[model samples]
Target: MTEFNEKQIDILQVAERLFAEKGFDGTSIRDISKEAKINIAMISYYFGSKEKLLEALIFSRTADLKIQLENLRNEAIPPMEKIDRLIEFYVHRINKNKCIYQILHFEFSSQKRSVDFKAFTEVKKSNLLSLEKIITEGQDLGIFKKNIVIALIPPTILGTYFHFNMNRPYYEEIFDLKTEQDYDNYIKTDLTKHIQQTIKALLVYEN
Candidate 1:
């Protein structure tokens, strides 16, 4: 993971929150300065511009994910175990970085041309490719079913988690969750297991 000094980290965190709440286009350097209790000069000195700041935030958030995925790829484990681990990693990460994921989803869905968008797209593409490799390895071993669409797997896993996270309020109401902890528990336990099982079944299913 990339390391940042305290001031830069503060600015990035504030920018992430602002971007999540307002949006990339909606946020300004002044907004981040005010929220971070830092001056505009410091932000400019550290990050150069609002767009660069967004890039820094994306790099910071994605670096760990990239490393984790690489490590999973290298680990001496069965393909099925790797898939389960990937699912669990994503569930935990999405829950922990809800705001970051919100901004990422928004940015990608916008389909605009910019440095930040490109950087985010590259990171996402790398992750998807890593996932595809895992699936391909399984197929080579005759563990995963042939003719499975590798490209769709990432979207299926991430989209399901995103849908649940985005609609938490509705879920909370429907499930009668009385506390934030209750909802989190449900996700960590039931939701995680369901996703793992679903993916495993899809991988092993005979046509």
Candidate 2:
């Protein structure tokens, strides 16, 4: 018998879906409970409250990303390899956490912000430190073609990713996309490759 049960994970999944579709302001304990087919008290029992549940969701996602990045940081890889690993990790993580990303996009953009998403922030800071170190080391070994403009590197990488995943819906609206899968295919093959190449071109390839 496992200590954790499906009921608990179901509640979190339901909450995540609700948060994604309706935004945090529109999602409630009853909404989650009814969608999850669990009693409202079950959520409180498992995660304390809605606010705490949201925090747990953020922490869970960030912890996964932090682990992947930390593994790359420990490996004996060049900066280019690290960048490729980061891209792969981001794509996989985003695919796994699309609901959470949707929820975050809504809640952060809306005026009714409640909980502060501190979990990803810590992970992001740690990743930036590692990226800075990678850049410095690459420069020392003459593997890089530039100086210490490390501050621009992290945001450039992250911003390109966010643009692809988060900014796609509006683009889809402007264009005539058939389905989500179609959009995803376009991004995975064309957009992702372009972004990765652009990053390498901008940061590397001296003259």
Candidate 3:
């Protein structure tokens, strides 16, 4: 597990909230300072610059996710169980820290071509690695169908999170889900059920 100092987390918390609210370029150092209720010098002292603070958020989130995913990746679990656990982990993680999905989807949508993209790349690749391992193992053991959309599952699953978490305005207006409680019911009752059903459809079935 990666241990972040209190100061680092404080800086990241401010950055995540600001980035979610105002976006990357739209947010400024002074804004973070004021929101964080810390001196501007502390922001600079910890992260160096506003740009670097944003990058820190990206890196920190990905790194933390990578660690959690690894712990859940065990060969003993059935592929379907593995798959379900992964989905549960993602949903739980995002719900616990809205900023995880919020900041990630926020920056990714910007299309600014960040230098820290590789940090995200590693986390994604690690996740894909875990998925592929379980999938191939299932295939070898005759637990999963031979023809599976294994490669594309990564993007599709993660994309679902992005679609729902990032597109708040659309859901609020279209589905009348503006409050946290409404959104909670949506995720637990509908959104999570939807993702698992889709995953079942994607995996090849050979009976």
Q: Top TM-score: which candidate number? A: 1
Question: Which predicted model would earn the best lDDT?
Answer: 1
Candidate 2 lDDT over residue span 1-207, tens digit each: 112367766777788888888877788999999888888888889988888788777766667676677778778878778877776666667766878876766666767656766766777788777767666666777777764466676557557767766677787787556798888777676666776787677667766
Local distance difference test values of all predictions, in order: 0.84, 0.73, 0.75
Would you list the clashing residue pairs of candidate 2?
A: none
What is candidate 1's lDDT per residue for 59-163, written digit by digit as tens? 888777877898898889999999999988888887888888778767667766465556666877888888888888999999999888877776787788888
User: Each candidate's TM vs. the true structure?
Assistant: 0.89, 0.79, 0.81
Please state every model's RMSD to the true fold in angstroms: 2.2, 3.7, 3.2
lDDT of 3 by residue, 1-207 (tens): 145698789878877887778877788989888888899998888778876777677777767666667777764777778788777777766677776566666666776655456656767788788778877876888777887767788667668866887787887778899798998888866788788878877775444
lDDT of 3 at 154: 63
- Which segments of model 2 are wrong by more than 4 Å? 1-6, 109-113, 145-154, 162-180, 205-207
- Candidate 1 collision pairs: none
Residue 174 error, candidate 2, Å? 10
